[model samples]
Target: MNLAIALTAARYGAATANYTEVQRLLKGPDTGRVCGVRCRDVLTGKEFDVRAKCVINATGPFTDSVRKMDDQEVPNICQPSAGVHIVMPGYYSPDNMGLLDPATSDGRVIFFLPWEKMTIAGTTDSPTDVTSHPIPTEEDINFILSEVRNYLGPDVEVRRGDVLAAWSGIRPLVTNPDSKDTQSLSRNHVVTISDSGLVTIAGGKWTTYRAMARDTIDAAVREHNLQAGSCRTMGLQLEGAQDWSPTLYIRLVQDYGLESEVAQHLASTYGDKAFEVAKIAQVTGKRWPIVGKRLVSEFPYIEAEVVYGVREYARTAVDVISRRTRLAFLNVQAADEALPRIVDIMGKELSWCEQKKKEELETAKTFLYYEMGYKVKTDQLTDRSEISLVPSDIERYKKRFRMFDKDKKGFITILDVQRVLQSVSVQMDENTLHEILNEVDLNKNGQVELNEFLQLMSAIQKGRVSGSRLAVLMKRAEENLRRQAIPVDRSGGGL
Candidate 1:
């Protein structure tokens, strides 16, 4: 829903993330008609001026950051709260159904929504300082996993390896501007015009995106006395949603020669304009990325979606994978395979230089690894500590990894990581989890499948792994056994 609104705004000539509003324009000293902003091309680092009757700062958690552009001393009105989500396999919830846990063990709301062939279970709320990138903590991960496990069926035991992805976002909570108690703060959205003639909008979720935009623009126009058009968004259908219907799903499959599941995925995501995207597959002879049965597909996203994202959307790798098609959120392994390809497709579409392509990859890497909280399991690493020198230790961790291979597929998955660690009694901080996982993931597949996890276990035991270096994971298994008051003799040895 939010994506459609953003795309619609872009259609009406709203320059996007490519240009940062550097400074504000002033007519006189104080009571002046607030003008447009000074835009700097992020790609080229070039600055230029533009005009607007009223400037609106709609940057959610970073509301103050942009407001500070107009006045450095501007105080933050938005109180940031960190929320983390865990993505589980689709089987956790039926494809057509979703699960919402109204409250968690911590007295907070958490939801397990069915999205992108995976169950997106989240949202841990903890008051946090505003940050551009929010990483999930070990306690955060453990809490979510433990809480989610409480709701899952008896047959379904979640493991860290079963978690395809983990992500955190900052909620732009409107504070009392005076008090700390949330009750004292207003639940309603606040649209305020700063002293420098900058209009600010904050404190809302997906449910409130439209109203937020409307209110912000309405306030801006009225305050500056600018003759702007009425909110057309009420009747303005997104590019893809126009004339959309369920029957179109079947028609799309028949017309485009696409699989049923593929058509359904497209129709639902892109709406009526799905045909436009589906057509690309036929023209390019691109293959539909079907992983297993028709129901269980890996890379449901196609080259067509990649091209559409670059051509129509922000044209960045992160936008393509993370937002446009949700490949990054859906499955990490598929996204890892598709990232280079998406970058290549975008590179060709955008006429990017070699250097530009490198820059895009670097930025996207930050989003995938750091922001999204997936440890990049790449082969290139200078960390010798992460290198395993012992076959026995590697074998031992492999056995433990099998426990997380809940489906017994010889591979570990998303929900497995923290679960197995904690079960073994190894717990570390959030930053440490990020560091260790990134280097330990040899394949950078996010999940520890095949021999990759075995390699990491051996490295940790050798006391070489940096983040995993802190509390030698070797203690987890032993500690758990001791806490249970059971003796675990190393001589007898256990997996």
Candidate 2:
């Protein structure tokens, strides 16, 4: 139904509409009822107006803001709850199926589901203040890991260093008049038309978005006496939903009902028409094994999927794996193994240069590092190997660094520094190198000269760097190398 609405809106050329930061709701209009929505495009700074007989505020946990727009006396309407998940290597468990832990250390239900090949275990319930971009703090991770370890065994260590990625999503649960615990708040939605006629839809999960939309629309239809037709969503199919096999199609149908096929496609690709993806994954002369499944092509399927994601779905590279596909949580190896192919395909499809491909790869890596809480092994170029360095190699490190200084400028970029560090069996923080240079660059010219670079590297290598001092040095080094006109010897890093 969500996809159906999106397709319908798209077919009608519904320009992308999002609330610019809401200015004060206009006063004394329509007998003090909310008359018009005033918003500015955060991107272009363009202001716009939308007049409605009834306005639906389905802004999730932030519904209270809409109440303020209505009359400022609506009271708090939502309680924020957080969900966190941790991604571990695929080989951690014997079975590919997911494991559900009914109890967590924090007394929440935890799910250890099989996501792709990787095992994704999560979730804690905690109250929080509403915010645009909410992040899971260190405490959240420790809590999740403690619970997960209880079930998986103490051997399942989740060090801050081991986390490839971690994320926190907010549940905009409806405030319960009788409930004491926020977790006890209803997952069901509430449709209330304020005195100002603003219809706010609060509370619900992804699985129940359709029902919420239907209820919200139905209320609007009756309240405004609009000429909109009866709900056709019950039978509508999403794009690309018709071609799947009966079993797969049935499963989709069960999940999405009348919009089964479309929902299947949309659920997989986030509402984009994925015909090109099917074409790319069609049985070819070559077949490659993926998580034991013999795929027609090794990774072109993933490559095509990524291409479709970026071009058709307005996805950033991070969005491609994090949301579009379960790659971030699935076989972490799969994503690492497919990176080259994905980048190559994206380069061809989007007409990107080598530099653009590198940038995208870097962005993807960053997302993996920080957003996904993935502890990417710097020593290994690919994620397929589970091996870690048993003994550090100081000589291999010096040689790698020597080679990475491509221009013989004596100064290395953060990429170079990262490569060398990884070669030496060291895993520096993602932002460490960049931060180091900032502190070491005494002239503030932004470039870390040979001496400054070496001094900073020595500090990091010697284990003397910490906190902001390390971050500044590392950051400055990366900045200096990235902006330098000189190019480094790519092959010296022992690729």
Instruction: Mark the regions of model 2 whose C-alpha exceeds 4 Å error after superposition.
Output: 1-5, 8-15, 18-28, 93-97, 153-162, 176-184, 246-272, 278-301, 313-315, 328-369, 374-393, 400-495
Give a tens-digit lDDT track for model 1, residues 164-242: 7788888888864445564644446788777667788878787766787788777877877777775655666776777
Which model scores highest in TM-score?
A: 1
Determine which window of 10 residues in candidate 2 has minimal summed lDDT. 288-297
- Summarize candidate 2's per-residue lDDT along 388-466 as a digit string, tens digits: 2212433444455668777664456656666765554445456555555455554333434444544454554333344
